[model samples]
Target: MALLINHCPVRWHAIYHSHWTALQYDQQSITYQQLDQLLSALQRQLLTQINLTTPPSMVRLACIASNGIELLLMQLLCVRVGWLFCPLNPRFTATELSQRLAVLNTPYCWIENEQDADSLPTSSPQLQIDFELLLSNLHEQASSSIAVTTNISTSAITLTPLLIEPEQACNIIFTSGSSGFPKAIVHNYRNHFFSALGSQRLIPLASQDHNLLSLPLFHIGGYATVLRTVIAGACIHLTTYPLTVALLQQHRITHLSLVSTQLIRLLADPLFNAKQSAIKHVLLGGSAFSEEHLTALAARGFHYHLSYGSTEMASQIATSDNSSQLQVLPYREIKTHRGEIYITGETRFIGYFRDNAIHKIAAEEWVASGDLGTLKQHKLSIIGRKDRQFISGGENIQPEEIERVCLQYGRVKQAYICPTKDQQYGQRIALFVLFSDSTQFDLDCQQLKHYLGQKLISFKQPDHYLAWPLKLANNQALKVPKQVFLDSLSKQGLT
Candidate 1:
């Protein structure tokens, strides 16, 4: 029998313990009862802190920490207390982090420790708390006889656990911001609840399943996995990065979420043998999958599904069926206007949070996804990002179209096409490729150009062939920052 999700509304008599495992990290496994106990205790301490300073509704808890039990618990605590949980990427450099914090203008920021807080540029005056120390204090207080409940309740707290509404804003996620500074995307509890339900319609999650927390909590995919597990009463295995096949087998992970880069690394890992994997279902997203990667998974008999989504829609808007055609998932609507994708539905985010307020989307307004795609017979095929399309010699050129052909050439491992200023064509295509091997191919630029000519029209063909940028070649990010490539081109006098 499945365990009950504590977040769901329930009758007073229906609340019961099931002893089902809720979380597993390393050797420690936390059951549903234990998880509820921890959250319940943490709630009082958190409430006391909030009541002492900011009201719960006005609280914007911006957290900078790695993925772990502590981070996950904080997310749950925010949900229970009706605070907007803003989890920033800890891997970002100090400058990057400070810039993001400035945009948020958040009232409170939580860091792992004092060292982490000291690293940031203190241009803004926001309350910074040591989250690890806060957790330790909570643990200490829980063991003490001092009644913390009265500390918060006696203070005339404006927010209470019972007051948390599903319609209230709950999460703030920053976009990748390949072109500019990341936008703060806000999601309500209803968005997440429907996102999980929509994904469950295509990808079934059972109580017996153990999903690997492969993605970070900063990304929508990672947070969605948490809720998906909760809604299914399943277990989420929280482990460190570089997930090995041994760990998968050890944890008995049944469901996995991965991006294209992670999938490639796994396929290349000498320790990875597909037949030995305990992973039954793999959900792929983040970017477009190459034909090479797809063929590799297919040959290995991997039951992988492709997903297309964004932070605005919560997580997955469409999931691939058995035939691998992306079909619109439940609770989300996808339509094309002049070949550009527009989205709206129950799972759509509230809006972009900025300037200390939510810039909400008008009711029944469709969000322009900035993605160009084609829909045929209820199946969607993503062409490319609309912003990435450039005009060359009065003809439109989509880099993805050329990149797709380059990947099909068999020698290219990854391909990216960017626009460069051209004296003759106004804007010309520049192709950067990562060969299957790190070394350059025997075929020179002329040969590559000749090959592309056969596959693409002369106007769409790249005028410049260059090696992949060194900085991005080693990037572990799910999506390559296109602006970085533009910078590289500027340095090389190509733009």
Candidate 2:
């Protein structure tokens, strides 16, 4: 029988997998036994600070760090004390971070290093905490605890458990908000519990598995990995390193997750040998999978699970295990109402946070997912997001439809179609193509337009073609900044 994830999986792991490897970073590994002691010390530090200022329940914490040991430790410690943990992307500029933190409403952020401290928004209201200082204290505690723990190998260390109810907010995950402004998704431990249990149905995990931290902790994909690892009592391989074939082989990773773009980078690498690797499963999400990429995955014999999800739904709403057909996870109920997806489940987030208040998304039968998908054979196939669909020349045009056609070709590596103003058509499709063999292939406008004409309808064809920017060459992340594309088009007098 599979482990039905409870609200307190961390505690369950502590009791059962005490001597098992719980976490690993660059030359650092922590067992569940050591983790219990570290959690105890951190708990005291957390309570010490809270008791000096306010009640533990009232104090919330956020983390601003790149992927590392400190960030992971704090994530566990925050939950142990029932303090909500908000993870911020290190790539965000001070301006971007400020805008997000303003919406998140000052939750005492923990900076990973002095460099991050310097990058803080000048003249912001958010309180900053020193992660290095806390690490120093933890080291001191570890020194004393190791000797005491060496003798008592077969026992459990008593931990101060948090009073975390099912509905209590435990995390705040900010979305990419590709449609609009990023949303601060408020989530409880119950949400993570359900999300983990549901995803396990598609990608079954075991206690002996080692899952790599492939995605950033700030994103829901990365956050979900952490949840799944803890619930399964599996070990997590942490790294500041990028996701590479060498890294996977070196660590002997049993499972990992990736975005389509990230996965493409690994597949494109000539050194990557799929047959020789120890990895058993790859959970792919973030964006749509192209036909070419899918073919490559199949050829390499990679066991991959495709998923469709959002931050508001914790992680995945629907998933497929190494197949084209997608089915909803065990915990969530999904339905299509007028071409848009609606979901209702235990995995649903509490709400969005802004202006020192909670803007809750009511679960009245279902929550509108802003995505359009069709169900055939009792399986879901996504067309696109409802918000991404736009009209062109009196016909409903989905950019993804055009993009899908473009990606079906042999040479094209990336496809992005945006709406540009057109007086005659009301709005026209602006296509941007990035070729795989840039040196051998000709990217002339007339040549590519003629190529697209053969595969697409007249109305569905892009009115304008964008010159691939040289700056984005060989970049792993396929997304080109919108403004960059628009600005380049204007300079060429195309818009």
Best by lDDT: 1
Please identify model 1 stretches exceeding 4 Å from their true place: 1-17, 52-55, 123-164, 270-274, 442-450
lDDT agreement with native, every candidate: 0.76, 0.73
Q: Which portions of model 2 miss their true places by more than 4 Å? A: 1-7, 51-58, 115-163, 441-451, 474-481
Task: Provide C-alpha RMSD values for all models, in order.
Answer: 5.4, 3.2
Query: What lDDT tens digits, residue by residue, belong to model 2 across residues 1-495?
Result: 333433355555666556677887755667776666666666665554443465544456767786777777777766666667889887778888878777766546666665666666644333444446655653554577675365335545454332446666777888776668877888877888888888888787788899998777787888888878977888989987778888888888999887666777888886655687887888877666677787788778788888888888898888887886788888887888999988878999878777766677775558788888897655888888787788888999998778878878767777778788788988888887777666644455566678789988899999776657776555444233556677777877667
TM-score of 1: 0.88
Candidate 1 on 300-332: residue-level lDDT in tens? Answer: 867789999999999899888544699988899
Weakest 10 consecutive residues of candidate 1 by summed lDDT: 9-18
How do the predictions measure up, each by TM-score? 0.88, 0.89
Best by TM-score: 2
